[model samples]
Target: MHAIDVNELYHILYTKLGPRHWWPARSTEELLCGMILIQNTNYKNVDRSLANLDAATNFGLAALLALPDGQLQALIRPSGFYKNKARYLRAVLQAYHDHYHELAALPTPSLRKRLRDLPGVGNETADVMLLYVFMRPAFVADSYSRRLFARLGQDAPYPQLQAHIAPTMRLNIAQAQEFHALLDDYGKLGPDVFGLADQYQLKL
Candidate 1:
């Protein structure tokens, strides 16, 4: 496996795919709910679940929190794991609403810690919230990124990979968010699309 230049790869993906405008949420509450509902499911399911939720709550976290477990579960049933996710959603959103102001005051590291402390927010989910929701510079070591780099022959643990890419790839919040989106979008494409099977030897 050859060494991959993180910045160079970012440029390649950006030039090829252009702007992704990702996270695909109109509000922070929707984004957070999507981030949780997205676990163990595809975006299709998440979108359907988000629609159901939006119709019910208009993307209000407080409204979502007010829903009974069964009702919430039914709304998000399309996302799969509805029972567990409903519980997680209630717990996390309650914490988010109660600590909303306090979270805004936290420095990035502390903020990430606080997010991770929420019931369903894992490292990747915390990073997503940090980057997209909190508008912080965070490298999300999500599955897409892991797969992309591993195929490029530079596999590493989540923290190590994130640390490796963050400095060079995450110049600021906007760039970080774009870079992450590009990686995921590229990962979703056919391997032949980017010639990643040959370790990113460009076809065009």
Candidate 2:
């Protein structure tokens, strides 16, 4: 155990693992698709699904919004749970079209509320979107984070976990983004494999 804080863990991971610059996308819509599609699945499948969507719509958000439900479902089928995810995507697009007159301009907290109000967006997804897309300093308390922290003798509900872990990491937008990516990516290196779990005991 390092007996460390979140900030120190971030530095260690950053030095060892290098930069992530995660949520790989060239546009907000692509990022939206990514955050939605990546749920309950890995990135490889999400990449294939995104490629299919690009082939179908030439990488245009308007074209995606106009795509029929069945076709949208088919294009993203490789991501698994296609029908539900298609509906989720449609709901998000519809929300954007109907109400996104100035959403990106809102404060991060307000933006998080709106994102969470959408059909499939949860706290984790909303925070990721906020951090990566809207350039907000929001830390994502995702499953990987929980697992990693549990191993460190710290486990709680999301809000409690957030309170426990966030204060130690004094992060701005870029640092918040990198910190979260490191927690998740390093945590994925489980005890049996190449992750951070087998290497250290984090009592803090």
* Candidate that would win on lDDT: 1
How far out, in Å, is residue 126 in model 1? 0.8
For candidate 2, list the clashing residue pairs, or say none.
Answer: 1-201, 189-195
C-alpha local distance difference test of each model: 0.81, 0.80
How much does each candidate deviate from the true structure in C-alpha RMSD? Answer: 3.4, 2.7
lDDT of 2 at 115: 92
Q: lDDT per residue, candidate 1, 109-174, as tens digits?
A: 789888888888888988998888788878888888888777776688888887676666535678
- TM-score, each model? 0.88, 0.85
Q: Report the lDDT tens digits of candidate 2 across residue range 1-204.
A: 346677776787789889987866777788888889999998999999999988888668789899998999999999999999999998887776667758887876678889999888988888877777677778778888887777766777787786566555577778888889888778777642444555656654
lDDT of 2: 0.80
